[model samples]
Target: MPQAAPMLRVENLAVTRGGLPVLEGLGFTLEAGQALVLRGPNGIGKTTLLRTLAGLQPALAGTISMPPETMAYAAHADGLKSTLTVTENLSFWAAVYGTGAIDAALDRMNLRQLADRPAHSLSAGQKRRLGLARLLVTGRPVWVLDEPTVSLDAASVALFAGAVRAHLAQGGAALMATHIDLGLSEATVLDLAPFKARPPELGGIAGSFDEAFA
Candidate 1:
């Protein structure tokens, strides 16, 4: 049988923040049944890169190729409706994605216990779990996550690791930026240090003054 194309492919990608380049010459491919952990220290532009991949922001340069509607992005915020109960929040996403019911997602993320509570009533960790649970209801094969483990406790972290593993087992793919280990043994690591962009020069007087002061 012929091989399949990657779930997500990025080539020589350059991403920017506030109109200044933050990451350049970035390239990677995520295949089905695979997960990639983006490893880099703080201020390394990992979030920017993931955002670019998710189409939240435009890439300064290079190309990203993937099937349409194939990606789901999770960021720092839970993206929840404070007035909505946990079940309602998830059901809303399911309806939006046109996927099946949210029962599996509730169980997968351990949110069943808090299902009836409004999102505003949940603790920080609880809210985070609910946010992560949104991934399951998305029904998108490619997940782009930024610091997914934030606000999660040890048990919840393990819970999330299992979720990612399950995603890959079903021929899905994930790319995430996180410091904590999600314990996906089959997941590959991609370090972003080498892809850091050079600092842009300051404008006119400030640039000249800095050069002269040095």
Candidate 2:
């Protein structure tokens, strides 16, 4: 019998930020219905790795294998329009992804009561909930999230966890960079410290003496 390939595969991937290598020689494979949590100290390139996997930035080297149009990314920012209503913001993403079911998405994120409220009026937690809701409408199989729980309260974190479980139950996968627990017991943890890039020689300094002193 033949086995299916992993939903997402990253091989010897390297990524750089600000023209300096931050992560290198990294690799991982995510099977469907599974979640992988990226764990490491601050400035260890977890976000950079997620961005590279999301195709938002070019990888310094290596390969990422996945079906086209199967990955969706959510960053720290909510990416909502202040002038748009909650439902409207979700609707916009649904339209862009050529999908529907905005109401269901809102409900999943516990935003049903705030559906008609303007995005600008929502609190930090509400905005984060809205951002997570956007993922539901994308219909993408793989989620690349950077700090998905950043501004969410305890109850909202539980809500987000439920959403993630539901996604996995439907054969979806997620790769997330988060400092706090997302309450997904089945999730695998990947500590990125081992993959940190070595600092450049000669101090890798730039700018003139005046700028340095300043």
Candidate 3:
């Protein structure tokens, strides 16, 4: 049988922050049933790259090749509605994504007990779990997460890791920027330090850097 294409592919991609290049010449492919952990020092452009991939921002150049609606992004923000209960928040997401029940998501993220509590009433860690649960309700094949374990206890970390493991086992792909070790034995680490963007070469004809690149 022929080899299947990657679930996500980025080739020669360049992205900017504040109108200046941050990550450039980035090329990687993520296949189904696999996980990729992005590793780099703080301020080395991991978040910017992820945001670019998540469609939160436009890439300065290059291509992101993937099937439409295959990606779901969860950022540092929990993205919860303070007035909405945990279950309600998840149900809203499910309806938006046109996915199924939130019960499994609740159990996986250990949010079942707090399902009836308003998001504003939850502690920091609880809020984060609820945010991560949004990923499950998405029902998308690829997960794009940034600092997914910001506020969590050891047990909660384990829950998050288990959720990721199960997601991969089901032929899903995840690309995440996280410092906490998920203990995913199958994950590949991609260090962005090498891919950090260098200032655009001065050609002596520039009005502005962005203009030169443009």
TM-score of each: 0.91, 0.91, 0.92
**TM-score: model 2 vs. ground truth:** 0.91
lDDT of 3 by residue, 72-123 (tens): 9998887899999989999999999999689999999988899999999999
Model 2: per-residue lDDT, tens digit, 44-76? Answer: 998888888888877778899998999999998
TM-score of 3: 0.92
RMSD of 3: 2.9
Better of 2 and 3 by lDDT: 2
Model 2: worst 10 consecutive residues (lDDT sum): 205-214
Model 2: residues with Cα > 4 Å off, grouped in runs: 1-3, 200-214
Candidate 1 segments whose C-alpha is farther than 4 A from its true place = 199-214
lDDT of 3: 0.88
Number of the candidate with higher TM-score, 1 or 3:
3
- 1-214 per-residue lDDT for model 1 (tens digits): 1259998999988887666677888899999988999999898899889888888878878999999999999998879999999999999999999996899999998888899999999999999999999999999999999899998999999999999998988889999999987878888999999988865553211112233322
Candidate ordering by lDDT (highest first)? 2, 3, 1
In candidate 1, the residue pairs with backbone N, CA or C atoms under 3 Å apart (3 or more residues apart, or in different chains) clash, namely none
List clash counts for every candidate, in order.
0, 0, 0
